[model samples]
Target: MPSPFILSGCSGGGKSSVLDELKDRGFTVVPEAGRRVVADALQTNSNALPWIDPLAFCRACCDLHMQDLAKLPNQERRVFLDRSLIDLFAYLEMKRISVPADLGAALRAVSYAKTVFLTPPWQQIFVNDQERKASFKEAALEYEHLLSSYRSLGYQVTLLPKTSVADRTDMLLNELDQMDA
Candidate 1:
């Protein structure tokens, strides 16, 4: 299986923008699961929302992420993921929710690349949408949790520079090229 390259950080931290840039550059990209879950919940008028039913929301996200991971082509050397299973753990931590044992097991079974691209909290670009309702302060706290989660999992967290999407894409491509060399 090809290990995924995860782009993780707080909400509205330009992860989606960076993912878009990678996709435009011809790389396979996996969209974030949380947004999809929220959209589905909203459409169905279900209580599977982060604020309303966080546990259910998280479970749905995990299921979707697993499906996405299963669909990835094994022959692909590198794929960019907007977020990974580890992010769920961070969310649980941030919400003071207990980590489900099964979820923990699932997270332990999967593996990602050692170097993860992390975008720090950037106030200039941070914005709350209907789906992403976390306050800027909450986003910052989430960023910190994400950093700790990745580190605890023993992955090298590479902080993406706070720059334009084009520049970030260039930086990522350069880093990948160097690693390939």
Candidate 2:
């Protein structure tokens, strides 16, 4: 089985930066599903839908995740994920959106990453990117939710140590190396 690696954390927790580093290290990486779905929804339905069709958005996001999963090459032994199915649960829980049974089961079937790289919220690095909508507080809540979701699902999550980006890169790689030993 490919080593599924999830980079889970708040929006401003340097998740994207981590993705960049991992990609530089020659690991195949999957982008976040939420931003992509939301962007497409905005372009198509200007009047409404996303605000009203929370379930639909969640479904779309789930489908995107599945697509990402399917796109992974079988020959690859390790792949980095920007987020995971657990985020869908977190998004629904935060938005008070109901999850469908099929979606829930699919999420349950998603084998979580052996090592979940989590970057804690850093207010300094946190900025209002074009895609970012949630406030720091809200992101923090979502971050907590993501952590709980993974733990609840029994994943062996590894919180990225508080260090420079380069250090974090080395730390994560070293941790994985140790795990493989």
Candidate 3:
């Protein structure tokens, strides 16, 4: 079976960039579904979801992740996940949004990569692009929340080095290579 590798962290943590690099190296990369969904909703209708409800948005996000997980091909050597379902909890906690009982339980069952790669907050490389909706400080809190959630679930999380994007990509690839050896 092909092991899925999840790249998760705060906004502007270079998760997407690293995923692109891995994709270029012949790895199957699943882009962040939340971003894609939001962009599409915005483009399709000006006020498609103007009044954002955290619970509603999170439900959609979870569904998107489940879809991605189901579509994975076992023959692929590696699958790179841009974000995992656990992200929804981070968003909920950050926004102080109440998590419904169903959503909370469902999220716990959503399995991500065994070795989740986390990118620490790197201010030098963190730029607020159009797609990046969270500020540096907000992202910091969200990152912490994410770490806590994963730890609480007993998932072993690995922190990616705070270095050049290329170097980080190489480091993860090397780690995966060792695992495959």
Candidate 1 lDDT by residue in tens digits, 1-181: 6688999997889999999988887889999999999999999998889999988998999999999998998766579999998999999998999999988888978888999999999999999888998899999999999999999989989899999999998998889889889
Tell me, by TM-score, which candidate is best: 1
**For residue 85, what is the lDDT in candidate 2?**
77
Winner on TM-score (1 vs 3): 1
RMSD of 2: 2.0
Clashes of 1: 0
lDDT of each: 0.91, 0.79, 0.77
lDDT of 2 by residue, 85-162 (tens): 788888788887677898988876777665687777777888875457778998888888888877877777788866
By lDDT rank, best first, the candidates go 1, 2, 3
lDDT of 3 by residue, 74-101 (tens): 7658788987877777778777777788
Ranking 2 against 3 by TM-score, winner: 2
Once fitted onto the true fold, the runs of candidate 1 whose alpha carbons sit more than 4 angstroms away are none
